[model samples]
Target: MNSPQTINGLMRHLRNDCKIQISGSYQKQQLTSYGYYHGYKGYRFAGNSYRQIPYSDFSEVVAVIEYDNNLKAALYPELMFIETALKNIVCNESVKGLKLGTFEHLYKERMSDNTTNTKLQSKRLKLRNSVYAKLAARYHDEEEKENQMVRHFYNRGEDAPIWVVFEILYLSDLAGFFECLNEAVRENILKQMNMFDISIDANKNLLSIMIYTLKALRNSVAHNNIIFDTRFKDRKISPVLKKWVEKETGIQNITLYSLIDYIIIVCCLLKRVDFSGTRALTLLNKYKEENQRLQNSVASEIYDHIIQNNVPAKVVGLEAYLNV
Candidate 1:
């Protein structure tokens, strides 16, 4: 078992074993403030923890830590807004458009009942079962006592409404439901999301695909996980989705490789939610200033690993779109 060490001991280990030059009058205080596990270990790599970042000095670690802290501060509110907006939009659209608000109605009427396509039918059955399991757990598990929604439904002796179900679902769960929705319903939701267009109408899955792509960053930022290197990106981004962003913003090579691409996604979503382009522009400029701050604080190579060359073009293109 590894022995626990004090801050001084950790600094010694970094110096002697890790060979990192960590020396400053205030570094110990900084270490104390952020802690060894979250501040240093969290910043020790780029993209993956196994791939150790080339940190020649302690200041670089400090730079990364500060950048992450500032990023979370900047993004937390925005994430919350996007999450609530998406849920509200989806729930309202589904209930009003379909003229059905109950879970069972939506599930039975909206889901595929085709016996000819066994695979799709089976897939949909599984999705239905998954939702049932989640609902059962929520109502019967310890959540019944602790969760107000569960308790409310528990007391009523009535099935939880679809809106109530939507309230409890995580963004990932919401994405699953969206993906399984009937094409017309899904496309209508996409139109309400302001993501409606010919390509989306053609490849209707793009809406849910986008939600899945955004899920990682949303969950990570909400949990205060590292994002500067976009290490939280855990899923495959479809080429069609990338092309859509490129077409919308007139920016080429819309790789979700850096943090700025995330901002672009958020900006697009914000636009969909009736937020002015000015608000997104504010976020972009804040990100730009944060980049400059980190650049001034960290080594160039480390900064380059997190922010790529195409980022400036992405920023400019997005800025132009917002300005328009």
Candidate 2:
């Protein structure tokens, strides 16, 4: 374990060891306010591995941190809304023919068919068992005693309803649950959620893609991870949705793999769910405002680096879309 250091010691390390030029007390004040580990170290990763930064300036690092903070603030509410909407829709559709809280319902109707690929079946069973184990722990634990829904079910000698259990599930857990369901059931849920214009096959494919993408975005936003330049490696974009985004933004190369594409996808989802999308629009505007200073600063190179690695057209198109 490394020895702990005070703020003054950290400031010295930044100036001497890191060779970063500090601008008097203001930078120190920021260090004190946001902490060296979270504020400095988090933004430091944006720099090259050699710890060399543009102009060797500490202010650029501060600018990057502020930009990320604004992004997190702008994204959290919209992502939360999307997560809640998906959970409610999926839970309602999944519990149709069975009692609310029984594992049998999931095994019979929701779990993947065992007759299919043996490896896939084993994987699904593992995921399902993990989820049930988590649920069981929560049910038995007093940690959730104050949760009114849990209390209500416990008092009545009944298991919590599907919706209630869903309340405890993380967005990633919800995505796994969606994946474990039969394709037809997934399509039915999507259709009920106002995705009916597409063919059943297309809808199934789109839902799988969206669930995977949204799960990545939701985890990033919820965990205060950097959102502006995220490129989801595991998510596969639906070609139909990609085409729609390209058409809407008039950007031919909108790949739906970066943060900008994710935002556009969320907007599309909001429209499908009969939401006005005002919050999403507001978030875009906020991001635009917060991002401008960094775009003009040395940190712009960092953004450019991420763009080079991902899709530059989508990143630039998102700014254009927000301005419009």
Candidate 3:
């Protein structure tokens, strides 16, 4: 039902239908670089099928896409670090507290909580089984023989240690595993991560929520999803931690919908875990650098307009982290 156009035809349609002003060769070069589908079509702001707010210039769309690409590049490494660090902390603490490495032990001692809600218990058991199945498959795979941990566990015939099993678990699985933990075990991991001020119950709940959020973020970054304009589905941060972020960032109305707020959350967790957060700082600096570069370009006003009207307000606090 849809007709295809050449790149130049697409450019003409953008000029005529979208009312975008294509200035010169530079804008055309950008269109060539980013492609028409992603560079132009993706950035359209439409309220309905018939009504659309045209980008003032082609450069505006290019700037937005470039900023998003830069952000994704900068965030990928830091997010990976945070994911690994959180997994390691959870597995180490859970092993010590629960006093077992095997999947059966974890399921029986920690995951098999006596819940009043049968549906909730059933959901958790489903997650547990899924994790077990994945780990078991990975454990027996011939390709995984080179993995020292996998080999060690396979030879032992006992279910793998927390560390070994973690070698195969996705970040989402790790977060789900944390949720399945007994309150005491979860609280121990939280305390170990330096969340001492909060009560054990609050810490357990907060960590569960934060990890879930981080898992979502990690998946997005890992899978090369657009980072800048993403509004998270589960945007609620725990009240106590929300207050802490408000204090730390000096941003009064912090919401997880903003990518900047998510970065701040990652920085907060890194600080709690004593990571120094150098990668987060690098990301903030990179953002500032990109913003500065845009300011010096011919597209400065367009860039400013896009940022002011479209980008998240929490992005303003990115500069503060440079001094930190």
Candidate 4:
């Protein structure tokens, strides 16, 4: 008889591991078959299921170990990716009349690609001076009324073409994601306010800065690049700006497992031009629910695990922007 190291010795190994005691009288009695817990017995391969057969029929025996580890290795990582991408889509598409209002556009373009998107890219001043003029005309007394107009104009809806909505959301600020996030950062980081109190330029340079930052984050995820441990190579922001980059870009540093969360923040901020600083968590929840079936079937448990560990709070601190 071959030793245990031989592939054919697996049956002998299994027999030794069994708790059932076999008497000497039963050992020589023709052994037919054996079964184990959890469908290990009668496992079929190549038209073979454990059945009573003569020893001559046992040409070869191979053992395969199957067990459930339940580690869910990619749960958080995949969730992070999905969350970030969806965030960008929802936020960017919420803006009204943005030229490149499609998730595909946001996914494809980089900061360098910003220069090529002429009509796709425009300063908020230009938008306010033109289509969103009512936003600029309002004062403290009628703040609520003016905010309603902005929401009506920019809210993402199925009525409009998907691309148009995406452009609006991506190009818009992320202030709508969280009210506290709004209060934490500079109001004019993107320089939406007009400079020199003259013609509507609205800090064209600042809008350009925002454009490039979003482009970098968008491209990184679209290309399956690493997010948590990333050092963006082609970033255009200065060292001082890097500290507040997430704030300026409207990225709430929560559990940045995916790029979608950041994108949603940007979309909500852009809607702020006309919105009353409403949060997008409700919408985010809806999106997650819609995809729950697939998530569950794929055995992805990151979202649930995150809630259990409360690890997301430690990953990104939106409150830090308040200090910056």
Q: Return the top candidate by TM-score.
A: 1
Residue-wise C-alpha lDDT for candidate 2, range 7-109, written one tens digit per residue: 7788888889888777568888988888877777766753234643343777777777777777777778877788788888888788777654555566566
- Clashing pairs for model 1 are none
Cα lDDT tens digits for candidate 1, 221-285: 88888888888988666877887887888888767877888888888877777455455766788
On lDDT, the candidate that comes out on top is: 1
List, residue by residue over 1-324, the lDDT tens digit for candidate 4: 954343223335444653222333233122223223222232222112332211111111111111011111222333334334444443433333446643323322321233444543443224323322333332232446754433443354422333333233332332222111111122233334221111222322333334444555545545544332222335434432333344443443433333333434343333333233332333334334433432343223322322223323322333332223
Better of 2 and 3 by TM-score: 3
Question: After superposition, which runs of candidate 2 have C-alpha atoms over 4 Å from their true positions?
Answer: 1-6, 16-19, 45-55, 97-103, 110-114, 117-120, 193-205, 231-251, 254-258, 296-324
lDDT of 2 at 3: 92
Candidate 1, residue 101: lDDT: 69
Which candidate order results from sorting by TM-score in descending order? 1, 3, 2, 4
lDDT of every model, 2 decimals: 0.79, 0.67, 0.67, 0.32
Superposition TM-score, candidate 1 onto the true structure: 0.89
Which scores higher on TM-score, 1 or 3?
Answer: 1
Once fitted onto the true fold, the runs of candidate 1 whose alpha carbons sit more than 4 angstroms away are 49-52, 97-100, 113-115, 141-147, 276-278
Model 3 Cα shift for residue 49 (angstroms): 9.4
User: What is the TM-score of candidate 3?
Assistant: 0.80
- Candidate 3 per-residue lDDT, tens place, 1-324, comes to 888886677778878877888746676777888888765666554212243333677766766677767777877877777778888888777767566677778778776555776865876887778877887677567464565666565677755666767778877777777877777777787777766445324546567667777776777667765566453334566676677667666766656655666777887676655456466566766776776665565354555443444234555664464356
